[model samples]
Target: MRRGRRKFDDDEADFVKRGRIEPALSEDPDLPETGDRWSTWDNALHGPDPLPEWVRTEHGAVDTELGMLKTGKEADVYLVRRAVPDTDKVSLLAAKRYRDGDHRLFHRDAGYLEGRRVRRSREMRAMTNRTAFGKELIAGQWAAAEFDALSRLWRVGQEGGTISVPYPVQLIGTELMLEFIGDHKTGEAAPRLAAVRTDREGLEDLWRQMTEALSVLARTQIAHGDLSPYNTLVHEGRLVIIDMPQIVDLIANPQGAEFMARDVRNVANWFTARGLRVDQDELIERLSYEAGLL
Candidate 1:
């Protein structure tokens, strides 16, 4: 019996094992066609331009289960998704569609756009003239400026390790696709810090994060002109900055320092109301010094 051990051929063993394994299917039955389900919303009320056919085609396949997360006068944020190829995966993304013809609010302020290189005085005159073509060009530039500032922030913050930004994917006209900073599976919108109450310890952390964000802005030569609780997101004990269409360039704008001071003051005062002690002037000086702007 000890001498009766038998050797199995590799091909025969593989054949026997293959019978137990199921053959691969041609297509995934569980998978659905891209953009099969369509959901519609009122663009006027939502601030998103009507989703273009190509955008829908490229990004509409994932469970875009449309939900209005936040609506402002300028734009609205929609929670969306796009399916990843070759894997049964869906990623949460934010679709911010700026309202068309709504550039009046930001574009009307010539001071904000000052010092930036304009192609021509004629173009600037056209923008100032408010002609149909001029208005459209201004709107396009405004949108492009937001996209540019956001891209800079995303890159600089990540590189400096001072903050985190959702990965920016594309900017199609007034529609911007960004990585959603919330948990979509649970269907919970990321709570803006302004909308939530925090304890003393949490408030201190928030204050620190805000100051750190300011330092990052200064380091990158940009100022978040509209920094406030509403634009700050509290996710997993971290603060994420958003809504930067009004971000200002420090080098180009003479009022950049004032804007930076105001930003610091605004965040500091908000935390002060919550029982956190912060000195606006000191914070501003520190930030300016750290940024080498002082």
Candidate 2:
């Protein structure tokens, strides 16, 4: 359950200083050692405590790739099983690795990067110019942004008992390892809200949950920016929000209201078409007022 960045031991530090460090064992395509690679828990950033009981934090743990679960324009999520060798302790994680360099698509990154900033002018210029290096930096920022947003919201959801998000297990560079939200035994992911066919009662319950989640974001002065039924999942009748790299600051971004309104309208229209009564304008007004955008 420990939190914060982990430091390397003296022996490992000296080995690194001696220039004896080589590629990580897991990086070998031959499936070096046991799993594809050693547990990244040693040096990568840790998640908030108290950590889940299934989180495998031991250094002896190895990560075995189960397969890819989902792929998107910016990132691809893989189902990985981290388990200690010769032990039953195991954790299934959704490893979301952001694409970098020429392979990454930045078609929608500009607007989302509006309120965010970099520390250096050179880096800022690169990002603005859409240079190769800049694209890489932007990719890293997206991953970090999602991790930070998820961490904050996860805590809020934990305390509020209304919203739900996958636990952010760890973040390393542009790779974010999240607690898998699905059936661990069968490795079957929860169905996206868009794919779910529910009864009227179920639709009402989902709409209620969605509104509450949006209200929470508005009160916190943030917006999902690209929310839709496709980015949400329904697990056991509970709604879970995901894909938040484009989370917008309701106060900082000038287009925040526009983004927030669009978010409300997108899902509101979905519910309304399903025979549910959702006043999009009313919800937008309420959320805008809550976000101090009114």
Candidate 3:
């Protein structure tokens, strides 16, 4: 559970401090004296407004990294706590920092980049050639895409209740801060759908939720290009989708239908294997129609 004041051991404190971006001066004049770094809200691109009250937007707010929550090929999510010193105001954010071109592997990027475009022909050529600059651009694109996708989906889900996504908090270069979907008090993340175990009734309910989420995405003309049980989380019996950096524009991408179908099959097969009667073909057809493909 969250304490009024959390203390970090020597090792933990050192780890957190090492991750901080220091200022030019020995003792940075710009940063607050207490936390690791000042609130980045003043410099970064912000999330959709009517912002949540929990978000610490004030300049007095500072961010401190608690620990890493997840690691992946493209990015690593760290548990970041943003708070106003001497105040009770605090927000827990999952800060997903994308690896730079030199460090990141681009094996899964080609297909997803088909429909996405950059204005400059030079940039496009560089991305196509996988130049050093191009890889950096691609990395930034992934972060921006996911942030934009989550922002749009969060608003839509709030209106319709068919799907759920973390509220995007902010994006700075390749670092995206999102609403941490877990026990805020304990800083423990919810289990992925792949790790969830449930009774028959619960399984059926989750399946229904999954279908509704897919339907909403189809109607919105987007495909979660890499959706799977591993990328989906269940919190308090609610299904929340995550990891959409490769989200496909259903009408724009040439293989959009294939991607959507593949997504459906991936989850449907899992459900069927667990003794659920999933009509994959039927679901696919319905989604295709909803996406205006039929």
Best by lDDT: 3
**Residue-wise C-alpha lDDT for candidate 3, range 44-109, written one tens digit per residue:** 899998898998999788888777776666877788889999999999998888889988744678
lDDT of each: 0.64, 0.82, 0.85
Instruction: Give the per-residue Cα lDDT of candidate 2 at 210.
Output: 98
Clashing pairs in 1: none
lDDT of 1: 0.64
Between prediction 2 and prediction 3, which has the larger lDDT?
A: 3
By TM-score, how accurate is candidate 3? 0.90
The sequence of per-residue lDDT tens digits that candidate 2 reaches over residues 63-180 is 8877766656777677888999889998889888888878765477788888999899999999999999899899999999899888888899989967788889999998999988
By lDDT, the candidates rank as 3, 2, 1
Provide the lDDT at 34 for model 1: 55
Residue 238 of model 3 has an lDDT of: 98
